[model samples]
Target: MSERKVRVIVAKPGLDGHDRGAKVVARALRDAGMEVIYTGLRQTPEQIVQTAIQEDADAIGISILSGAHEYYFGRIIELLKERKASDILVFGGGVIPEDDVPKLKAMGAGAIFGPGTPTSVCIDWLNSAVREKWARETA
Candidate 1:
C-alpha cells in the first residue's frame, strides 16, 4: 500500500475565541509533515465533525480554553458518534482542570494534552496514534 499522509482538523469550539495556541499547534503539526486544517475560532461541534468528515481527516484535535471542556468535548464526541466517525482519533488541549482529563479520555478522546504540554509531545502523539490506528484498521 502507498503511504498516506495523516490529515488533522484543529478546531476551537463554542464561545472560546482564544486561538493563539491552536494556530501554534497547527503550524507545529504542519512542520512535522502532517496536513493540518485549522477551522479558526467559535466553531460548533456539528461544524467541527462535518469538517473532519469533509476533509477525510485522520484525526480531530480541539483546543478549548474557556473552561467549558466537558460540555464542548462531550458534545463533539457525541456528534462524532452520531456521524459514525468515531474511528477518527479525537484529542484536544487547553486550560483544562487536572480532574477532567481522565473523564475526557474515558469518553473516547484519544488523548488530552492540557495547558503547558509541549508542542512536540502533541506532534509525537498524533504521528504515533494515527499510524497505530490506521494499521489496526487496515490489518
Candidate 2:
C-alpha cells in the first residue's frame, strides 16, 4: 500500500507581514513530498489552530519574525490543548533567538528554528517527527 503524505499547516501567526521564509519552507516541504497548506500572513492563534483541525493536519509550522514567538506559540498550543488537538505537532521558525528556543519547546513546540537554519533541516526533522507522531497515535 502507498504511504500517506504528511499534511502540514504553515502559518504566519500575528502581525508579521514578511512571509518569504515561510513561503520558502512551505515550498520545500511540498518538494519533500508532503502536503503543505500555506495560510498566508497575519493569522491569529485561533485561526491557525482552527485551520489545522479543519485540515486534519499532522503538524503546524508557524513562522514568526516579529518577536512575538512566545505569545503566539503559547496561545496556539494552549488552544490546541483546549480543543484536544495537541497531538498535532507544532514547530516554528524565523528570526527566533537562540535563548528563547528552550522556552518555546517547553510550551509544547516540537522544534524551534532560528534564522540561518537550513530549510532541509526543518524538512528532515518534520519527516521523522511526523512519522513518529503518527506511529504513536496509532499504537
Candidate 3:
C-alpha cells in the first residue's frame, strides 16, 4: 500500500468569532506537510468530531479562546470516545489556562498550546505524535 499524508481537522468551536489563530495554525500545519481540513467557525463539538471521522483525519486541532476549554474539549473527547474514534490524536490551543492543561490532557487531549506558542513547536509535536501512532498501527 502507498503511504498517505497525515490528515488533520482544524476546528473552531462555540460562539467565539476569533479565527485568526485557527487560520494561522491551519496554514502552519498545511505547510508542515499535513492535510488540513478547517471546519470554519462556530462548530459544535459533535460537528467537529463528525468531520474528523468523515475526513479520516489522523489528528484534530481545536482552537478556542472563549474560556470554555473544559466544556468544549471535554465534549469533543467524549464524542470521539462514543464514536470509537479515540485513536485519532486530539489537541487544543488558544488561550487555554495553564491550570487546565492537566485536566484536558486527562480527558484525552494530546496537548494544549497556549498563546504565543511557536508554530514549529506544535508542528514538530504533531509530526512526531502522528508518526509514532502510524508506526504502531502499521507494525
Candidate 4:
C-alpha cells in the first residue's frame, strides 16, 4: 500500500473570534507537507472531533484564546475517548496560563504551544509524534 500524508485538523473552538494563529499554524503545517483541514473559527468541540474522525486525521490542533482552554481541551479529549478515537492525538495552543499546561497535558494533550512559540517547534513535534504513533501501531 502507498503511504499517505499525515492528515491534521486545525480548529478554533468556542466563541473565540481570533483565528490568525490558527490560520498561521494550518498554513505552516500544510507547507510542511501535512494534509491540513481547518475547521475554521467558533467550532464546537464535537464538531471538531467529528471532523477529525471523518477526515481520518492523525491529530487535532486546537487554537483557543478565550481562556476556556480547560473546558474545550478536556471536553474534546473526553469525547475522543468516549468515541474510541483517542488515537487522534489532541494538542493545542493559545493564551493558556503556564500552570494549566501540565493539567492539559495530563488530560492527554500531546503538546501545548503557548504564545510566541515558533511554528517550527510545533511542526517538528507533530512530525515526530505522528511518526512514533504510527510506529507503535504498526508494531
Candidate 5:
C-alpha cells in the first residue's frame, strides 16, 4: 500500500507581514513530498489551530518574526489541548532568539528553527516526527 503524505499547515501568526521564509519552507516541504497549506501572513492563533484541525494536518509550522513567538506558540498549543487536538505537532521558525527556543519547546512546540536553519533539516525532522506520531497513535 502507498503511504500517506504528511499534511502540514504553515502559518504566519500576529502582525508579522514578512513571509518570504515561510513561503520558502512551505515550498520546500511541498517539494519534499508533504502536503503543505500556507495560511498566509497575519494569522491568528485560533485561525491557525482551526485550520489545522479542519485540514486534519499532521503538523503546524508557524513562522513568527514579530517577537511574539512566546504568545503565539503558547496560545496555539493551548488551543490544541483545549480542543483535544494536541496530537497535531507544532513547530515554528523565524527570527527567534536561541534562548527562547527551549521555552517554546517547553510550552509544547515540537521544534523551533531559528534563522539560518536549513529547510532540509525541518523536512527531515517532520518526516521522522510525524511518522513516530502516527505509529504511536495507531499502536
Candidate 6:
C-alpha cells in the first residue's frame, strides 16, 4: 500500500506582508511530496487553526517575520489545546532570533526554522517529525 502523504497548512499570521519565504517553503514542501495548503498573509490565529482543522492537516506551519512570534505562536498553541488539536504538529519559520527558538519549542512548537535555513533541512525535519507523530497517534 502507498504511504499517506502528510498534509500541511502553511499560514502567515499577523500583519507580516512579506511572504517570499513562506512561498518558498510551501513550494519546497510540495516538491517533497507533501500536500501543502498555503494560506496568504494577514491571517489571525483563529483562522489558521480553523483552516488546519478544516483541511485535516497533519501539521500547521506559521511564518511570522513581524517580531510577534511569541504572541502569535502562544495564542495559536492555546487555541490548538482548547480545541483538542494538540496532536497536529505546529512549526514555524521566519526572522526569529536563535534565542527565541527554544522558547517557541518549549511552548509546543515542533520546530522553528530561522531565516536562511536550507529548504531541504526543513523538509527533512518535517517529514521525520510528522512520521513519528503519526506513528505515535496510530499506535
Name the lDDT value of residue 103 in candidate 4.
96
Reference-based lDDT, each prediction: 0.92, 0.93, 0.93, 0.94, 0.94, 0.93
Model 2 stretches with alpha carbons more than 4 Å out: none
Q: For model 4, where is the 10-residue window of minimal lDDT?
A: 1-10
Q: Residue by residue across 1-139, what tens digits does model 6's lDDT show?
A: 9878899999999897999989999999999999999889899999999999999899999898889999999999999999999999999999999999889999999999987899999999999999998889889
- What TM-score would every model get versus the actual structure? 0.95, 0.97, 0.96, 0.97, 0.97, 0.96
Q: Say which prediction, candidate 1 or candidate 4, comes out ahead on lDDT.
A: 4
- Return the clash pairs for model 6, or none: none
Cα lDDT tens digits, model 5, 20-139, are 999999999999999999888888899999999999999999998889999999999999999999999999899999999999989999999988988889998999999999999999
Indicate the residue-level lDDT of 6 in model 3: 88
RMSD of each: 1.3, 0.9, 1.1, 1.0, 0.8, 1.0
lDDT of 3 by residue, 42-122 (tens): 999989999999999999999999999999989999999999989999997999879999999999899999999999999
Clashes of each: 0, 0, 0, 0, 0, 0
- What is the Cα-based TM-score of model 1? 0.95
Backbone clash pairs in model 2 (N, Cα, C under 3 Å; residues 3+ apart or in different chains), count: 0
Q: After superposition, how far is residue 135 of candidate 6 from its true place, in Å?
A: 0.6
